[model samples]
Target: MSHGPTPSDVAAVYLQQGPYAQGHDPHGHGHAEARGHGAGGPAPKRVIVGYGFWIFLLSDIVMFSGFFAAYAVLAHATAGGPTGRELFDLKRVGIETACLLASSFTCGLGYVAALQRKQLQTQFWMFVTGLLGLVFVILEVLEFYEMIVKGAGPGRSAFLSAFFALVGCHGLHVTIGGLWLATMMAQIWVKGFKPQIMRRLLCFNLFWHALDIIWVALFTIVYLLGAGA
Candidate 1:
């Protein structure tokens, strides 16, 4: 087999192509060398990040699927506690859902602001989005507290357990999202929305949008369908 370039030969190649094109195997590993020599055209770091994030999302989806199956299994085991039809207030849930949806929209606008380098506007919108998320979580917490106080706790029924399991997980995410937004806002004030911050924003966007998708399941599976049947 033609073993191609030694270090000296690769140095000649590097000299010919210049530093940008001649990918230095910073890892000093054979795979790095193979990548540079391979027909794959020297894969960029962004490609690695993209592929990694994709696997992360897929694993998250698998985890969520387990929750969904649990919910399905426990959907009808209301025990003696208040059932979905008896307990769910669609008008109120609708309001909370809309608030969360609107927060996601404002988050998108905030991303645009960061892209344009409008630091103040970006922080302002991020805070607004965070506040909306906070409001959503507060409402959910209020609902749960009121129910548990009235003895409709998760311990009262498998249905309630699954309900809290699915929807409460979403509420927890919203709370974390609020904190993340607040942190990002502070980082913007201190460091400005640089490329690294922009990457973070993209990751948060994925999280925010995933929350919205999960809420769709809560709305349909836990609320609309449950209430109807």
Candidate 2:
């Protein structure tokens, strides 16, 4: 004759039921651990890296926000010195903005090439992006030199100080980004789109895009508005 269900078999059936249908584990233990209420599983390395980088990016943005606030407060404090409308050159600013924006596009293309494992295309696009960034930086340097020669340097007044601090900070970031692109190109050449290298590339793309966004804000608030004022 067939035997009745044993105690262990009954316990298995209970566990097979929905989690909420049972108040606790059949073993008289809390269901928290089984229900993923305890420590989470170890995150993947990619996820960990991405999360850390996002925190870094957010902190960087906070710093920029502080700078923006300072610049806004001091934008009109020229103290009888050259104003933004008198000192700024819209034609050059337009060209610099164009180059930087174009570089962002090429940077995206390079990232796509990297994901496809196209080493040559990646290198080509990254090189183009770096060249464009370089051009933007050179234009910025020329603008600074022009201002300095015209007695409108950062030390000239509070307005100049804030303008230099804000614009110079962005220029510095672009310079770093160009260096990062070069490093990525070299790494891809030697390592061939390895997972870790791809992660770095992804981070670089985020960083470069962030710079683009910041530049847009700077252009709008500092350049366009300042010029109008």
Candidate 3:
């Protein structure tokens, strides 16, 4: 008579076909640990940092959305004051747009240099980016000053109030981004592309790029449309 399989045979079969056979640890770890601890443990530092920064960016977009909606609603509420068609200067605004868009390109180049670990190249591009950003901010401030001198200040009418609230918020973001870019440049100079520093540079790249996207919307809606109106 044929006997049943022995205990040793059973154990051998289990070892060949069980969870351990698929690289599961007997101590309860899974194959994910071998693949960089992505399942049971924390994600990679780069992933975690990037995800967090994206969340912050989304929240910022939401805030800007609120301002845009307010501007749209009050866009025609000039209350017989100077309307956008009268106050807007498309020429200056066009120059500002060019500077900001150019800064975004330089910012991308800096990020690529950072990835390649070229310190001098990264610094050079970032310096150019910051310079362009500074020019944009100066132009915006001068625009505001000119508007105010012409008595089209925010307090003059509901339309002007909404205009300043929307455009000023974006200008403030650009100023903050410029400050952030300076900080990142200083850190790269001192730290020399450490993991944490690279992560920060990536965040700065995203932040700068997002600002460019926002400025495009602002330029089309506020400057172009306003001047045409």
Candidate 4:
């Protein structure tokens, strides 16, 4: 005969875990020890989402770290071609860096506004952040345009290739970040701080700040040191 749970057993399961629809735990883990129902899962949806997204961002950071390392090794080894010292413009880089850093700060304010449930403030600050990010990408593209026009394209030298790759990666990140910010603006209008919406917004915040940190490293290595070399 096949063994199966009886109606009384089902009742016992429900009694133990309450009516949260968290489903039956055959192991009888109980409500106090569940994974996401205010137990080991930790602070509800917001915290759990933040934790998961942070993990994703950390993995992305690792990928960027590899890119940075590769760039570092080849940034100055230009194979008898023009080196970073001959190509970089520190003033332009400084302007790009300032735009990016300011965007990050505005993003921070948007996160705070989101947490406070200030819809107007959140939307305004997010728009500001996106605008600043767009500006940064434009400046970076212009810089690249100048380099390419001056015969410093990635095909010209290993250093130039690494330089373009590292900075271009950052430029791509800002472009995507701008899209995400615009999506969030639409989301707040439609979803209005729902747990899932907030989850995504906070996740994007983590990602945006992580990009900023990578930019700092790039600025120091590619712009500051590269220019000096």
Best by lDDT: 2
Task: Write one digit per residue (lDDT tens) for candidate 3, span 1-229.
Answer: 9476666765666677663343444443334243234445657789899999999999999999998999999999999999889888888898999999999999999999999999999999999999999999999999999999998899999989999999999999999999998999999999899999989988999999999999999999988888898
Model 4 earns a TM-score of: 0.82
Task: Estimate, for each residue in 67-175, the C-alpha lDDT of model 4 and write its tens digit.
Answer: 8988988876788887778878888888888888898899999989999999999999999999888888888889889889988899998778877877888789879
lDDT value, candidate 3, whole model: 0.88
In terms of lDDT, the poorest run of 10 residues in model 4 is: 27-36
Model 1, residue 205: what's the lDDT?
A: 75
What does the lDDT come to for candidate 4?
0.83
Number of backbone collisions per candidate: 0, 0, 0, 0
Q: All candidates' TM-scores?
A: 0.81, 0.83, 0.85, 0.82
**lDDT of residue 57 for candidate 3:** 99
Best by TM-score: 3
Residues 1-229 of candidate 1: C-alpha lDDT, one tens digit per residue: 8565678876775677554454455323333334444666656655566567767877876777888899999988987668888888888889889998998899999988989999888988888898889888988998899889989888999989988888887788788888887888888889887767777777777788788888877788889988887
Query: What overall lDDT goes with each candidate model?
Result: 0.80, 0.89, 0.88, 0.83
Error of 2 at 188 (Å): 0.3
Quick one: ranking by lDDT, best first?
Answer: 2, 3, 4, 1
